[model samples]
Target: MSVDTAAIRRIAKLARIHVEEEALPGLAAEFNGILQWIEQLQQVDTSGVEPMAGGGATALRWRADEVTDGAQAERVLANAPEREGEYFSVPKVVE
Candidate 1:
């Protein structure tokens, strides 16, 4: 399948991409190459293939569900030039 200049212009307008008149031919050629690749992929035979949820069938490993404050308050506040007790102090900008 070949993409014409008009179709390229319409695709560019829909995607909000700026395609100049000189660059439209090159862009259309690239789009035609992509469509040709898709056409070739459509010719592949997959009669007995089983579709999985994702690319692989490996189960995801999960850690224990625990919630905490991350235990790095002092380490995190060490880089603050101005801090108040355990938090960074910022200058009042709004009344």
Candidate 2:
């Protein structure tokens, strides 16, 4: 697929990018080159290739299951709007 200046302008407008009139041709040409490269890549032969999981045959690394955030009560409530001791003192919403 060819990328024309009009298509580039429309894409830029949709992406919230401000493309000047003179720069539209350059951007369009660049996009056309990228599309051409993608087309060329699609022409490669991968019929006999097997898709790998996680891009390899390696097993997933596991970590120890442990509590990591129970000792930071004061730090966690440091920036609270209103805090009492190590906890946040919120106003009673229901009477």
Candidate 3:
């Protein structure tokens, strides 16, 4: 895959990148090299490979789901500057 100066210029225009006229040739060569490397990668065979989430074979650790009361409402409200009944009181914002 050979990337010409015209193609590089078009890519720069589409990407909103400003490339100087002198740098276009260098940019084109670099792009051509990248495309050639990608083409080489496409020739590899991976027909029987299974997709993996991580490099290690370890399983994820998990805990059992259970419900419990957070029984310290009065203790928590004691630190509040303004608390009403069983809740924190704040200035109402809406009319």
Query: Top model by lDDT, which number?
Result: 1
Candidate 2, residue 56: Cα displacement in angstroms equals 10
- Candidate 1, residue 1: Cα displacement in angstroms equals 2.8
Top-TM-score structure, candidate number: 1
Cα lDDT of model 1 by residue, 1-95, tens digit: 78999999999999999889999999989999999999999999977876665555767889989998789999999999999999999999999
Better of 2 and 3 by lDDT: 2
Give candidate 3 misplaced runs (Cα > 4 Å). 54-95
- Using TM-score as the yardstick, the better of models 2 and 3 is 2
Model 2 lDDT per residue over 1-95, tens place:
99899999899999999989999999988999999999999999988887676654767999999978778887789889998776789999999
Q: Which window of 10 residues has the lowest lDDT sum in candidate 2?
A: 50-59
Cα error, candidate 3, residue 27 (Å): 0.6
Total clashes for model 2: 0
Q: List TM-score per model, in order.
A: 0.66, 0.58, 0.55
Local error of candidate 1 at residue 25 (angstroms): 1.3
lDDT of 3 by residue, 1-95 (tens): 69899999999999999999999999988998899999999998967875577545757878777675468888989999998988999999999
Our model 1 lands, by Cα RMSD against the true structure, at 3.6
